[model samples]
Target: MPAIAVPAFALAWWLACYLISRDPKRATLRWQAAALVSYALGVAAWTMAPGSDTAEILLCVPALCWAGAVVALLPLTPTERRSVDRGALALGAAFLLMIVFLPQAGRLVVLAPLVGGLTLLWRLRAQVTPRMLPAALTVMTVLCTAALGLLLFTSGGARAAIAALGLDLLVAGYLVAVAHAAETGERLRPDLRRALAAGLAVVVLAGIPAAATMFLVPAHDGVAALQFVVLAAGATPAGLGGQVRRLLDRLALADDGPLRSDRAALFLNADALLRRRQHRRLNTVGETEFLRMTRRALHDFADLNRLARSPLTDLPSVERRLAGREDQPRARARELRAVLRESVSALRPPGPFGTTDDWRYYNVLQFCCVLGINPYARRPKTDGMSREARLAADWFRRYVPEAVTKQWIREGAMIVAERLWSEVATRRQELPAGPDGAHDTQPVNG
Candidate 1:
């Protein structure tokens, strides 16, 4: 089982590394991938020389790799990418010191990575929200700490199985954490959030019996404890099945308000425009295609009002600007204007613009001017934007005076709108009829 476990873990880490490597934007995943690669190497080394002292020393590689992953997960400032390198080096140094101290430092070495991860979590508690990943990590940490204590203080067949279970929990926790981090920009629906919470609650409830069996039942062996934990974890999903169904029914009955087909259409158009930019394939060069592109770009401009309100803004700068300022009429006016300017500047595409980049800025400016989104307003005229987005709207506004006149912006927007109407009409005509023989002329939402 040990031999199989080594190879299985190695293969899983290798696959995870491969998938994470494909996306450059996944900084945390990249570090985790690197850690897994390191771990795989250590496993291979230990497998080749299981009995050797050198092989045992090589196990430190996985420990360092785990520490590296924790470092990667730290919430650093936006400008400070790759801060994990310094943290990893420091951790490596600590590991080396522990080795030099030998027998006396053995327990310290085991505790080091665990302590580091928890310390980082503690420091970032304010920034970290109460989410699925963090909750899983907390549980995993507690289990791991207990497992470590058992290993140091006691030893037997039960210890090995319990240790294996703890490792499994840690691996599961890491996977959940990475998945959550990857989708940090996504907003969770209320129903989904409730479902997740309920699922977790069920798991906790199932574990209570297991905990009682382990601690209260004095005659139970290590094997019995291990069995109970496994059974409890496994039974959680099955036990929650009825509750899950009820939650689903409740969710279905809940009103989600009217569908904004226009917003959906704009998102689709923006995606199409981005794809065209990426592929650099101008399949057709005509007035119609140009107008289509312009229409998409204009939609993107309008969408910027929502996008700019992202929580990724320079929060410190914002705080500083608004600090100690009362909400008096004059002060409120100044704050609004400042935020509007900031918001507009946030929408500006970085680097030099030509025909290639010009469309983005043009779209944003045209949308702001034509849509009549007040440059000095505290909030967007439209509702439904997230709090982060509203904050962005509060800080930034459009800049339209540079290259084009207001007249040109307005005219260009109208031209795009006219072209969009014609294109939609053409598409509706081309669409095939439904089964009942009536033409299904509903336009694509996005």
Candidate 2:
């Protein structure tokens, strides 16, 4: 791409974003403007940098700085606002300076600290909102772009390739760490404390294996290979750590499940009363209805007091509820049950799959179960016994038989697949019917 064209592209992008920002309905146009400007500035950095040498690397710093700046300026909780702003500003400034003066080596060093620090600070604040996450992601994009540009500029061939792979793993690992933090609602400092402890454990786990790899290979690249192994391992847990954090969150909020909340029932009851008054041609129906609604609200409130409360992660009881299958213990099933119990606690009501408001929790449990069943394949946990157990594990007394669990997931997956295939199938059979006809819609094999 020509150098002049880069700036032109930036200008056009900024204008588009600015126009979008003007519409009150799209109030987020301002952020979009920031994103566009950041993009243009980064492009300008590349176009104007010394030669064509590592232009992307140089540009990444400014781009990321712009992204970080945007995120920092957004409304955040007082505590979160302070930490995120401090960390983002610190990293953003450092990266920008590196872009200006030391484009080459500064790129690599900038990413490790910038991402690591932001992850630490964001987690420490224990704050997350839809806006906050997107902003954080934008900041992350800056970090990644810089790192990739640096790798492209610095090395070539096998060395560069390997380094790029390593960097990718590092980014993935950091994301996992961030996820862990989000799930736990742990302040950055507390998460770091746990990470440090886990790091020691990782060191122990890898010590001998790494040593053996080094000794057996006895080459410089061997050392690199060993290092990669450790990083990859660290990264894997960092990814899973977020999940554990979410589980912890579920456990804490265990008593807050939907079945215990009477609001839905109250609404139903009040609606019925309103209908009755309308039929009687009551003159003060509106005011009377309001009072009745309020009364119903109070009645619903009392139900919160009525339900038996217990820790969602009271593992033994959850395990017992699921019925301990003597067959290999279904480690996946048991673990999933623990997670589901937590979901039951965390979910609000009117969930898509679970018992209302708990849909998101059901979604998460299903994801974990699918991961356990077919780690190689990515599938939704929407159908099957997993979904059933996820819905009922905390509340249902019956054990989810192991075979039922597996069959449910399999059949559910099959039903979905068959229906999709049937859509495209030439001699189409009716989309296989589920037991509940239109509602169940799960396919049965002919």
Task: Report the number of the highest-TM-score candidate.
Answer: 1
Q: Weakest 10 consecutive residues, lDDT, candidate 2?
A: 305-314
lDDT of 1 by residue, 303-360 (tens): 3422222221112233356678642222322343344344444544556432233444
lDDT of 2 by residue, 133-184 (tens): 5455545556455446544465443233223333332333333334422232
Using lDDT as the measure, the top candidate is: 1
**How far in Å is the alpha carbon of 408 misplaced in model 2?**
52
RMSD of each: 21.3, 23.8
* Local distance difference test, each candidate: 0.42, 0.37
